[model samples]
Target chain A: MKILVVDDEADIQPLFLQHFRKELRHHDFEFDFALSGEEALEYLKGNSLEVVLILSDINMPGMSGIDLLSKIRQDYNYLSPVVMMITAYGDEENYKQAMEKGADDFLTKPLDFNLLKEKLKKVMNNG
Target chain B: MNFDYILLLIVFSYLRRALQSKILLPKIDKYLAIGFWFSIVLLIAGFFLKFTKEINAWIAHAMLFTLIYFCLTQKEFKSVKSFIYSILPFVVVNFIEDCIELINSPFHDEWNNYFDTAIFFSIVWFFAMFFITRKQRKEMEKEQLKAIEFEKEFQQSEILKAKLETQVAERTAEILGQKEKLQKALDKLKTTQVQLIQSEKMASLGELTAGIAHEIQNPLNFVNNFSEVSSELLDEMNEEIVKGDFEEVKNIAIDLKKNLEKINFHGKRADSIVKGMLQHSRIGNNVKEPTNINKLADEYLRLAYHGFRAKDKSFNADLVTDFDENLPKINVLTQEIGRVLLNLFTNAFYATHQKQKKSGETYKPMVSVKTELKGKGIEITVKDNGIGIPEAIKDKIMQPFFTTKPTGEGTGLGLSLSYDIIVKAHGGTITIDSRENDYTVFTIFLPTE
Candidate 1:
């Protein structure tokens, strides 16, 4: 399985890498990182690999996660990727927007690895 | 004794007539004078005809009648006095005639017969004058009695006028006291209004502070996240450098490219928060511009709740959108409206979360935000199913510094500042409807044209 993670936070990638590397022994998964929405779009344009999961953070400086999600939905609404939104604040408006932008699930952070793993299992099955 | 009594009675009759003239017939001095002379003539005729008993008895009766008349007419005593003065000369002349008849009794024989006649005439004249004087004295007594009654009445009227004046003074004092109390109440009301205004101003400042903290914190989180990643990349690079592994260093260098890009990403975020703050706090400059409300509301609502989430990772609300495609843009301050939306969404979350915390009643609270075109205006509604507002506190919630939230969680100016932004600043309206434990909806209307 291949996953694309779009976040402005550099620390988030390592956190994911550490958690995923410890959990998955099959070595069947590959990970890609984009620091911003524009970079994420650029990376999508360059890559031909089929990505199954996309985890994104909504707030960023320019071309926010919502905008990126909107663009992604516009381009590939039919793609059955399990897109999960990771955020620090647990407000309804953002959750609603993320879903409207074609996000499949939502997770709030202090980075619970166990919860993420459970959510990934469900999302992978669904995908 | 009979002649003396007759004279006294006649004299009293004349006095009564004189007093009556003075009191009742004051305007008819001529008639009073004629009547006095006529009485004197009757006295003289009585002596000549030898009718002393008849004349004396009639005079005695007339005297009593005159006294009664004088008593009745004594109310006009001043006029009666003038009439009596006018008859004074005639009374003296009659007295002189009486004296002459009395003195001629000294001659004897032929004079003795004359002397006897003159003595009777003299006695009749003297009695008539005596009766007039007695009547005058009684009339004077009657006049004095009337004067006493008038004096008593005058004193009573004076007392009444004095009492009325005192009452007027008391009423004036009472009215002045009431006016003073009203003025004091008015002063207290003015002070209370001023305090309310002052506290409202302070609350706005507090909201601005909290908003700044919240906005800036988003970028700070990014900074913290990015910095940790960059430090890890550097640590890996250092390990590759110490081992003198050029091929691994090249791969790490390529890996560091994405982490370096994150520095730019997080830096720009911090800049935007500062910029939003600058725009939000700019005062006294009218920067109202035409803005699409639907776009603004959707964007800010998302941003306001950008990082919020549920504890159960599976739960998510169904979002329904109903944007009016025909709605025209309106002149507005975008950042102000953004702040207003932020406050509203924050309140919605607070309400819904509280409901979720309550035992046995944890129905997944739904928040609906809708926009509609309403006759040259736009109506936006933010509705939530949560612990709703109470009727008693509904009106007070719009007042500044009034909060239902726990301490440190609320500044209480959220709705009030939102009220000011929509209604006072934009010339729009904000209305709230809520039922306990059912739903709370805030509707805002802004003119499109």
Candidate 2:
């Protein structure tokens, strides 16, 4: 399975990479990264990667995770990749909006890698 | 007339001077001056040897002039009686001189008898004048004293009245000052009331959000778990079918039945999350109860951190807990304090997170929560290794709507509400200590009883 992780923060990339390095080594999967929702959308276009899961942070500077999720649900229905949202905010309104935009999962920070793994595994297996 | 008579007149002057110096003393000097002038004129007239009767008449006239001068020099001139008293001594001297002349006369005739009668009539007039002058002087002195007493009384009353008025004015000013202070306090109270209402509204909203999230997450977790298990079973079935293992495929179908039973398990979880939300939104509920502090603190801290983790996959913070095991249970509204703790922890994480971003430093940011039992009170300290609060803003941080966080980054009511909860509601104290570029500690002391 191929997963695309979208977040605007450069520091978050390293943090995520540090936590998932062992998992990356063990799993028969590849993870792609995008610094913005626009970049994630652009990467999806003309790309031959068989991406099965999407993990994105909600509070991006441009094009939030919810917007990307809605776009994917509306425009890329054929792909049908499972979408998981990450956010620094844990407010219910955001959770509701994300679910309404077709997000398969929602997580608030400081994210526990174990929980994230369980969620990702479950989402990918289901997808 | 005689030495005794002269002694008696001098005694009268002395007594009058002692009783009323203002009435008697004015004529004293003038009488002495006239007496010396009349004695010199009497000796000179005798040496010249004028008609014996004529010389005696001259002496009488001189003596009368001296008496008239004494009368003019007297303090009181109220009536003719005062004038007669002034001349009474001169009249006695003249009658004695006339009796001596009558006894020594060369011819013993009726002329002597006429002289004696004239002297008798003068003595009667002098006595009448003397009594009238004494009455008039006494009246004048009494009236003068009465006027003086009335004037002194009027002056004293005026002074007392002025003093009383001044005291009243001072008291009035003091009352006005107190009224102004009370007015200012009332204004402050009104402002605080408005702020309290606004904070309560926000707190209610936070409670609703937390409940809704809990409800949604429960069912969501089960759906996620069940779906993964089903997908795994399907994958296993597909794998066995590809390997042409008919027995393995049949076995997988049986396993699928057990996974189906778990489907309702996840459904029930989703239902509970929904139920929690409904309960949270309901108003006027009796939710307050005596809660175990150590247990609640641990559970709520876990929930708060995990709740945040449920959103951002990459967000992480180092948290340390040192709860006192022996601390007594506290009575509180559990949900409200839980929300407060969540807010503090979230803010601590963000503050450190922002610093880490700015410094580009790889150091681990630590947030430590510690509880201790001290006497009848429990102290909870939350310390964070974040960009410490500035000295200038330390006092203002607990003020409502005061924040250094960027807009949308914070609601700016966390510390303020936390302060109110601990101080006003729980009868506790919350104090903050911070060192710039080092760390910040928030200490809360709540009574056990």
Candidate 3:
């Protein structure tokens, strides 16, 4: 399975890779990273079929996570990648908006790697 | 003649008493009293011992001379118009006596009785004249007494008026001194009031702590995540070393080192943010230092944006900045200029936020900051596409305690304090350009030398 992780924080790339080192080593999952929602869209446009999962941060300058989510759901709906929103704020409004915009799951920071692995396994089994 | 002389002695005594009482002529009064008593004694002696006509006439003439001498010796009596009248009776009696004596010598027995009756009638008429003159003198003396009393009263009143004027002058000087003291106190109070308002402005900046906390969270998140990742990478490195795979261990070690560097970077980022906040909250030392205007403008702009974001999570606006790279560092009180920038940015954000709420999705709230190197100085402008300031209140925006915001929502001292900081403290100029419901631009010029 291939995954796309989108966040404004550049450190998120190394942190994600380290957390999923075993899966990356075994070639069980292939990961790509983008620093912003705009870069995420550009990545999706090039490799929409290869990416099965999209994990995106909600808060970002220029384009927000909700905007990205709605764009993906509207523009690339047929590709049908499982979208999960990650945010510092786990407020009910953000959760409801994410759910309404076709988010498959929600995650709050600081992210629990164990739970994230379990969710990824579930998505792998479902896919 | 003897009756007339006795009457003249009585009238002279009465005149002396009147002069003493009304005009206070003690010396003349004593002389008149002595002459009157002596004449009485002489006349009584003549009546008892039968003194001859020659001796009797000599005593009467001597008494008349004494009375005239007393009256003439007093300067007060000499000035009176009534003095002549007082002496006329004595003169007439003496003249009539001489005439009768002369006529009797020519026809001694035949005309003696007729001449005696004529002398007696002449004495009666002069006596009446003397009484009338005495009454007139008394009235004139009473008028003179009234004039003296009036003169004394006028002198006393003049002294009292002088005393009152002096007191008034003293009181006026005292009042002027008090007025000066009050004016100084008022000036001191005004300065203290300005300081209090300045502190109040700082207190409002304290509200930015919430936004700072939010800002700190981002770097803190990275620090936590990177540390966790580094720990996991260390565990993997140990496992690879146990497997005798030196290449994989080196790779893990490199990853760990990168993670540590990231942790350090993020930690320092958080530190700088905290330091910036502390600098803003602390009171300024009012010392001028060479500072990069661009960096100051950018830092405050972010602070204001994040501060607003922390309050209204739904609010977001495009923050556009065009800082001049070639601009020279200018001398300014860092905290004071920072405060001015923060105020302008915060106000811009507020205006846009308000317009966003009212105009909804159609309004794209935008705040832009630009710095340029104008002639002899640096020019900074903060422009906002928000609900612009109304034309009527444009000039009043920089007045202390003047606000268009709802009560309690704003301190209203933001622009006023900014105005003071830029114009008064730093010797800069701040100007505003705004149009209702369109846009607002605040331009500041700080000279460099």
Candidate 4:
């Protein structure tokens, strides 16, 4: 499975790669990282719908995670990625924002990777 | 005859007749006034002077007394008492004259022969004294009438002065009343101005808080996600160590150390957010600029919806927006107005979300935003299918610190701050329409010009 991670911070790339080490070794998952929503959109322009999953951070430098979700819902909705939004506040506002923009799931930080993994498995199983 | 002599005879005839009429003389049958005058002339010309001289001075006194009685007894005189009073001065004069005559007669026997002269002088003196007393009395009566007329005029002026004073007092009271009313109106205006200022403060605070919330949440996302994944990595390393996989364990520790770095980085990022919050507040000045209101409203509405979904995954709602194609861009404070839109959209979603909870899956939560062209301005409406605001709290919804959301869930400043931004700052209007358990719609009117 190919997955995309969109965040403004550079630190997230290393963290995501390390966490998914077992899956990558087994060829169970492949990952791509974009520093911003604009970068993510640029990358997707070349490789449309190749990534099946999208994990995004709500706050970003240029276009926000919600904006990316909206663009994805608009352009890639026919053969779309399962989009999930991550939030730090666990604030209801961001939760509703993610859902309103067609987010398939949402997680609050400090994220419980176990819960995230379980949710991913369920989405994957359901898909 | 000479003219003077004839005129004097005619005058004497009239005077003699006048005296005869006063003495109750008999009237003739025809031309009685002429007959009396002719008879008086004949009697006087032929006999009066002769008889007056032959008669004693006592008989002359009796004739004069009768003339006086007739004159005084006239209707205009009112009483004969005054005619009798005329005799007093005459009687005193008569006594003085008699004493002089008696002394003169003893000194000169010729005084008896000149007695006619004495009588004539005494009669002239008596008449002159009577005329002087009458003239003095008439003068006294004229002065009394003048005093009465002056008193009447004084009384009329006093009444006029009193009326003028009443009018002046009434006009003074009217002016004081107008001044008092103006003061009260000024006081009311000041109160409204104060309320507007307070609302502005609340709006600024709301904008600042949203900034702080958005800034801090991102780093925290990183910090929390890395910490959560770290323990799982440690577990993996422990399992790898049991399999004697030292290289894998080393890789796991490195991953764990990297994760810790991320946590540290994001932790500091959150700390920096605190400093940034202060800076945000200090720098916040609402400056208006040209903005496409439709794009702005759409963006904030999406943000609000997603933010709500992030907190409660089970919560769901449909958001719809209808934008006028002809709507023009207008100048506005972007951040402040953005905060107001965010707050309104948030409330719409929250209300519907609450209703969805009670009504279950059959209930479809829907929130809509609509913008239209309204003369000289734009009208935006935010509507939702939700458990409506109760009638009791409706009026107070825009008041500061008044909230229906439970204790920790809401600060209750959302609507009030939004009210300040849209209505006070923008010189706009906000009105609400709602029904219990039905729906709520908030209409906003903003001037484009």
Name the top lDDT candidate: 3
Which stretches of candidate 3 lie above 4 Å from their native place? B1-7, B14-18, B21-31, B37-53, B67-199
- CA error at residue B10 for candidate 4, angstroms: 44
Q: Per-residue CA lDDT of candidate 1, range B1-449, in tens?
A: 13333443344455446446566666654544554565555556566766564554355345434633553466644434434443333333333333444465343444555555655665465457557756876798788888888888889888998999999999999999999999999999889765654454344435445444545565566556555645665776788799998886786667567656666776786686667656655543458898888887765554444323322222233333567777688898887786787678767766776776783433665666788889878898988877999999988998877999888657677788789889988989999999998889989998865
Misplaced by over 4 Å in model 1 are A1-127, B1-214, B220-343, B359-366, B388-438
* Candidate number of the best DockQ: 3
Q: Write the per-residue lDDT of candidate 3 for residues B100-129, one digit (tens) a residue.
A: 565676564466676566656655656676
Q: What lDDT score goes with residue B274 in model 1?
A: 68
TM-score for all predictions? 0.46, 0.46, 0.80, 0.43
> Of the pair 1 and 2, which is ahead by DockQ?
1
Interface RMSD (C-alpha) of each candidate? Answer: 8.7, 12.0, 1.6, 8.1
Two-chain DockQ for model 2: 0.05
lDDT of 2 by residue, B1-449 (tens): 23223433443343344435345545654554455455545545545755553654655554554545444564443233355454555465565555566676554343666555655656555557656666766887888888888888988899989999999999999999999999999999988765664555455445335434643554454455545655666876898899999997886677566556555765775575455434434443445577676765665454454454444433445567898888767777665565556567666666666666667635556777888998778888878888889899999999877888788645677788788878887788888899877788888888876
lDDT by residue (tens digit), candidate 1, A36-125: 878888987766248778788776544567777778878766765667887766678788878877888887755566677787777667
| Model 2 residue B295 distance off true place after TM-score fit, in angstroms | 4.5
Output per-candidate TM-scores for chain A, rounded to 2 decimals.
Answer: 0.89, 0.89, 0.97, 0.93
Candidate 2: residue A34 Cα off by (Å): 24
Writing each residue's lDDT as its tens digit, candidate 4 over B351-401 gives 998998899857878989999999999899999999988899899999977
lDDT of 1 at B381: 91
Q: Please list the residue runs of candidate 2 whose C-alpha ends up more than 4 Å from where it truly belongs after superposition.
A: A1-127, B1-191, B197-288, B298-315, B319-328, B332-340, B361-363, B372-377, B390-403, B406-435
